[model samples]
Target: MKLAQRTALVTGAGSGIGRAIALCFAREGAAVAVNDIRRDRAEAVAQEIRALGRETLTLPADVSDSVEVRAIFEQLTAQWQRLDILVNNAGIVELEPSRQQRLIQAHMERLAGSGAPAPLAISQSITDMEWRRTLAVHLDGTFYCTREALKLMEAQRYGKIINMASVAGLTGLAGAAAYSAAKAGIIGLTKAIAREAIHCGVYVNAIAPGFIDTPMLAEMDAEMKRLIALQAPIGRFGTPEEVAAVALHLASDDSSYTVGQVLSPNGGFYM
Candidate 1:
């Protein structure tokens, strides 16, 4: 009951790491608000939270939309009137088939001892819409949600904000320039806001997880998945529950002294 009587809002709680975190908080005695672009998915997670005997609020909204985000906070205030935790976990990844095919071919060439460098023109291949959408979802969505959460948190003089980053942000990943940039921006935003919000008793931190076995990875072919798992020193992809454990720590009083820090759950992937 580390979070007894507390309240939390987790974006992207429909599935994967976000859903795990929502359930973890609920188990710890927090009334959870589940948010996802898909209403059915949000409701599904909300149903799980209710089964745990915790109050649940299902919020279906695209975080990238400022209007929608504001409406979400308004609903939160009307329902609970307080927000103790905010997890900005909603994100999306876009990789064109042509780009991925090119990357795969280059990888195969290198494996065949071609000696020639792989021309990963990921940046050049990114469509304007893809670039903007990636940032809009990860970076802009985080900001929109955080801005609304801060109003509630700062007023209460107590809050925990956790931003989900990635190892790709720390050690840039090939073929994912937009995603890397978005995550890197989140890290920067987390630090800057952590410094500003700490004075108001609102602690902000980030979690940069490595390859986690989430739906996000479902797009990768089996071979690509195997290769990625081996990339981690742990020799396997991390689980959603593993990342949720870290989120729980940051959400609770255990991380009282930790602020403006990027707590990476990367299993020896990027040092």
Candidate 2:
């Protein structure tokens, strides 16, 4: 087991990419801390880790909330004593009900097969409230978790951080300006931290995925998805398991010489 005896924390572990990463880490012999917005979902992932005979702790918290993020670290310290790997995977693309009800309603109507596609004009039509909410979760949340994890990693003089970005960050995806901006920031942040912390044996890296077959993409129109898949030079969408393999590589000693790099498993969709 590459990660035997190490400790890992995977945010948004209730499902999708996060769940896959959490399970992959556990199988590689890492004690995993699973965080999700839903308590039930967190517990479910935690149970899967336990089934592998690996230690696990599950707590539901909003990664965008500094208070909650700090509490998660405190609890992790109490349980695992140290964090060897941190996967900043918690993120959301949906707008809050209170802030963008009309936009969401129109979008949902389209998804329900009622009308023309309601594509939000990312650069001009987005509201201030919607922009803030998306950035709060994707960008601010990553900063909060990383800031807290940094202190712990610095003290130990060893660490591995895997920040999740997307192809949107490299080549902005239409209709997702906020998400694109946030992910781009993550790549910049990863490089900045690596330069500062590398001498101390703390490595920071990022992963940029494209057209992954995950639940989040389920909302896309069938034709849209098919067209996107065709754009992949590989002729197919990637799987969570495939991404998890890359995460496992970065989290282990195998990646000791690699730092501040954004690894993309986009099937040649982006290079």
The best candidate in terms of TM-score: 1
Whole-model lDDT values for every prediction: 0.93, 0.87
lDDT for each residue of candidate 2 in 1-271, tens digit (9 for 90 to 100): 8999899999998988999999999999999999988899999999999999999999789999999999999999988788999999988774333324445556568669896765554457678987898888888888899999988999999899999999989998766788899999999999998898888888999999987888877766665567678879998999999889999999999997898999999999997
Q: How close is every model to the real structure, measured as TM-score?
A: 0.97, 0.89
> Tens-digit lDDT track for model 1 on 1-271?
8999999999999999999999999999999999999999999999999999999999999999999999999999999999999999998887466777777778788888887776777788788999999999999999999999999999999999999999988898888999999999999999999999999999999999999989987777676667677778888889999999999999999999999899888788878
lDDT of 2: 0.87
Off by over 4 Å in 1: none
After aligning candidate 1 to the native by TM-score, how far in Å is the CA of 52 from where it should be? 0.7
lDDT of 1: 0.93
Maximum-lDDT candidate = 1
RMSD to the native, candidate 1? 1.2
Off by over 4 Å in 2: 94-122
